[model samples]
Target chain A: MSRSTPLREVHETLGATLTDFAGWLMPLRYGSESAEHNAVRTAAGLFDLSHMGEIFVTGPQAGEALDHALVGNLSELVPGRARYTMICATGGGVLDDLIVYRLGSEEFLVVANASNYERVAAELTARGEGFQAEVDDRSDQYALIAVQGPRSQEILSSLTDADLAGLKYYAGLPGTVAGVQALIARTGYTGEDGFELFVAAADAVSLWQELAKAGDGYGLRPAGLSARDTLRLEAGMPLYGNELNAGLTPFDAGLGRVVRFDKPGDFVGRAALAPLKDVPPRRRLTGLVARGRRVPRHGYPVVLLTDGTVVGEVTSGAPSQSLGKPIAMAYVDTNLSEGLAVDIRGSHEPVDVVDLPFYRRSK
Target chain B: MSSIPEELSYTKEHEWVAGLDDGLTVTVGITAYAADSLGDVVYVQLPEVGGTIEAGDAVGEVESTKSVSDIYAPVTGEVVEVNQTVVDDPSLVNSDPYGEGWLFRVRIEGTPEDLLTSEEYVTVTSSEA
Candidate 1:
């Protein structure tokens, strides 16, 4: 059975279409997903990201513990800052992509994908056995909400006095929002300016309602997973199950920068990934845009247009509302990134190999 | 619940058939319930005009942003005409599923039977919902 988020009643009141995602019944969309996508691009859209996992590591050696457990140099991350990192098996396969926030000198918050949180928490505990830290899975205690787009700052500023303009990207500060305590972080998955609010589960509904009213004039509509997926896709961000999985290394996904081999400690996958830093994999993740209206869906084989040789498979795909065309992320031959066609259903639909991000927000 | 026109005959595949009273040619399209469930229709691949299709055969496909579904033939017949307008503007499948969004016209090959009435289609959709 899928679990419900704390804002389930609120989402129902808004007439959202609910779908089971990562064992949680979350809103798929409030109404038209395209409108929500456009809203985030031109205005702002709200998101309930409570399904994300929050594992806390506290003690004097929390940062060191994370550095040894994951692929990033978490100890170098200063307080009020966050780093996007990955946890990998000793053999170098990724366990999950994570965002580790250094809340304090001894406290670090590791936010993980909902489906891999249990494994991530367990891995942290096992990896930090010798470190002077306590690993706690407090995901249930927190509810995460994000306001993303060009108007996000304006919408968020109305409810909080937390130096929204001064908060650097990927930084967070503990502040009161709409009379409730929250850790407002300038982080987001969508390729837009945004703030992610981490609040107590009980305060979710009230905070959401307040933000809704405050953002009404700013065109902030409650967005769902459908719009979220499209926005992330347009931004070229990878979804956990789609792009980052236990079977693939970060290098395979062309995200080798997130793996910091020069960190002071010997971390998991350090030995395996260190040798692969300069070596290119057999296949590299690339983006594809269909010339026709037929969408390239997940698990569809990408082939060479000339010989029909199966080269790679699409990992994530959708009709891009912004591009006004079908876009997809696929792992194609590292040597050849052009002239690819996705065998959609049975027809080999031609697609062009484009750069990773299909869209970029203006700074 | 989606609207099921009383003048149309329905199939378990969620397609609606009209002009069955003529017993010579009929129009076929996906029901509104199917269109709503599929979200925005991005592409519609209709069977070729004059192509022969058997009842229950997968004739074409409807692609959405999130998913895709096959459009099956409601009755065995030759495809008389295809809606090029819907093929060009797929969103019509969602905005007007039955009228201007009609998928294709088929010349009936035999007596149209084993299809549901509008009331039966409504019952099916409600229960599924």
Candidate 2:
């Protein structure tokens, strides 16, 4: 049986089309994907992210423990601050990418994806030999809801006393939302101004209801996993299963900044990541936009114009909600960058190699 | 799923066939119910005008964000004309599902049974719940 989130009933009640995803029943949509995508872009949107995992690390030297398990320097985090970090195996492959929340001097919360919950917990617990922190997987006890878009602050600020404005990006604060004590983090997967509210499992439904009601006038519609994927893809963010997996390192995913080699202590993947810094692999992921309306699908082969030789395949492709055209992200050989050819049907068309992040939010 | 206009015949593949005054040409399009269920039609790949298709064979493809569905031929026929409007403005299917959204007109050669009535379709989709 697939695991159900606390808001499962709420989604069905709203006529959501549900599908099984990564061992969990997730909502695919309530109506049209185009309308839902526009809602998040032009207005506000709500999402039930209760399927995400929340783990806690608490002890006398929790920072020391996190510094060892993560590739980033956790010692630099002050209380109430948070940072995006990745957990790696001993060989330097990624275990998961998560947010490290410094709740207190010796307390921290690591928010991970739902599918990676068990793996993240087991790896962290097993790697706790030299550290003084206790690793506890508290995923079941908590629920997450994200209010995203430009007007997210105006809607969320109505119920919270935490002074949401003072919270910078990647910062977490203790606050009360919908009459329940919760943790509000100024972070989200969507490339919009939003907050990820962590509350007790039982309080999730009421909080979502309140957020939806309060945000209704602002065009806040409940979004499903389908729109979430489009938003993240437009933001040029990586998905765990699609982009980052256990076998791929942070460097391979164009996230080299997360790897902190300056720190004196050795991380799990430090030795393997050392040589990659100077000379990375030849294959790189690049974004493409089709000049015509022909949108490419996933797993479509990219070919070289000179010899019709297949070089790479599309990892993710969709009709861009923001770009208003067919955009794609594909893994291409580094030697084939700048100007490459993508096989749409039987014909190969030229594609320009721009920088990473096909779309950027205007200031 | 409106009246199915007593003048028109229904196909099990969810298309409505209107026998035109020119006996050999039959106007064909998907029903409103089918279009509504498809949500917003983004892109469609249609067969050439002279392409021959067998009964139950997929003559084209209709794609939305959530799904990519095959447009199966209702009867053994040759595609004589296609709506180019869908290629430019695919939303025509959602706005005017039964009219401007007609996928194509076919010069059917043979007639098959199993086509449901309007009342029968109402019973079929209502129970599809």
Candidate 3:
């Protein structure tokens, strides 16, 4: 059985196609996914991200506990800011990618993926045993809503007067939005200027309706997981099951910059990841642009056109509405650039190797 | 409630058979229910014209963003004509699934068995929903 979010009724009322995602029933799309994707690119789109887990770590040593449990140095993060970090096993394999926000001097909120939140909470509790921090799993109590896109600020400014102009990227603030209290964070996964409002579960519906009404004139649409997936794919963001997993480390995924070897304490994967930092991975993650209309899908083999040897596999793929072609992210032999073709179904369709991000919003 | 043409026969595989009463040539295309469930159709691979196929054989494929499904032949026949327009523009499968979205025309070789009527298909679809 899958758990339903607090906004399940709201989504159904709007005629959303709901699907089971990470043990939770969530909206897949409201109508045309391509139209929703375009709305986020040009205007703004509202998202129901309540399936994300919110784990709170509080006490005097909260930052210290996180530094020892995760890859990044959470103690270094100033208040009202968030950092995109990850948790790894002792063997240097990634456990889950996270966004840690420093709400106060002794309070920190760690947002984790829905599938891995329970394990993350357990691990945090066990790891913080000697420290003066307390870990609590509050995933059910919070409902997160994000307003993302180029016109996100304009849309949000109509609802809340909280210093939207002063809040920098990765910064968060506690303020009233549409007469309701929320932790409005200037963060988004779509590579757009957006805000993620974390409110109580009981207040999600009203908050959503308020934002929807405020954004009506701005072409704001309710985007679901389908559009969100395509938007993040075009932004070169790594998903947990697709790009990051227990078998691959941050270095293997080309995200070595997040690992802070200079931190004071020894983290969980410090020793294992320290040695592999200098050694290049066998296969590096790269982008693929299909030459034909056939969409390259997941688990498809990426091969060398010269000999049809399977060099790597596609991690995530989709028909990019922004690029007007099918694009995919795959792991190929390190430095193998030429003669690339994705084995689409049975036929080998030609694809061009491009950079990681297929699209970037102009700043 | 998807449209189930009373004149055409239906298959449990979500295909509709047109010209079945003519007893010589029948047109095959996925039902609207199948197309709606598949979401947006981005690519359609049609079978080669003038190729012999058996009943229940997977002839072609329909690729959507969320998933892909095989277009199966309803009866044993030789493919006489394939809809080139659907092959070029796959959105026709969602827009006009019963009309321009027809997959292929088959020169019937044997009797099609286990085919359902429009009423029977409506019951089949409603139960699944």
TM-score of each: 0.98, 0.91, 0.97
Note the residue pairs that clash in candidate 2.
Answer: A92-A269
Write one digit per residue (lDDT tens) for candidate 1, span B1-129: 678889999999999999988679999999989988888889999999989999989999998878999999999999999999999999999999999999999998878778999989888888887
The stretch of ten residues in a row with the least summed lDDT in candidate 3 chain A is A28-37
TM-score of chain B taken alone, every candidate? 0.97, 0.85, 0.97
How far out, in Å, is residue A105 in model 2?
A: 1.4
Interface RMSD of 3: 1.1
Residue A2 displacement in candidate 1 (angstroms): 0.5
RMSD of every candidate to native, in Å, equals 1.2, 2.9, 1.4
lDDT of 1 by residue, A97-188 (tens): 99999999999999999999999999999999999999999999999999999999998888888899999999999999999999999999
lDDT for model 2 comes to 0.81
- Comparing 1 with 3 on DockQ, the higher-scoring candidate is 1
Instruction: Give candidate 3 misplaced runs (Cα > 4 Å).
Output: none
Arranged by lDDT, best first = 1, 3, 2
Candidate 3 per-residue lDDT, tens place, A172-205, comes to 9999999889999999888778999999999999
Residue A130 of model 2, lDDT score: 74
Tens-digit lDDT track for model 3 on B28-108? 999999987887788899889989988888999998777789888888899999999999888899889999999999999
Q: Which candidate number maximizes TM-score? A: 1
Ranking by DockQ: 1, 3, 2
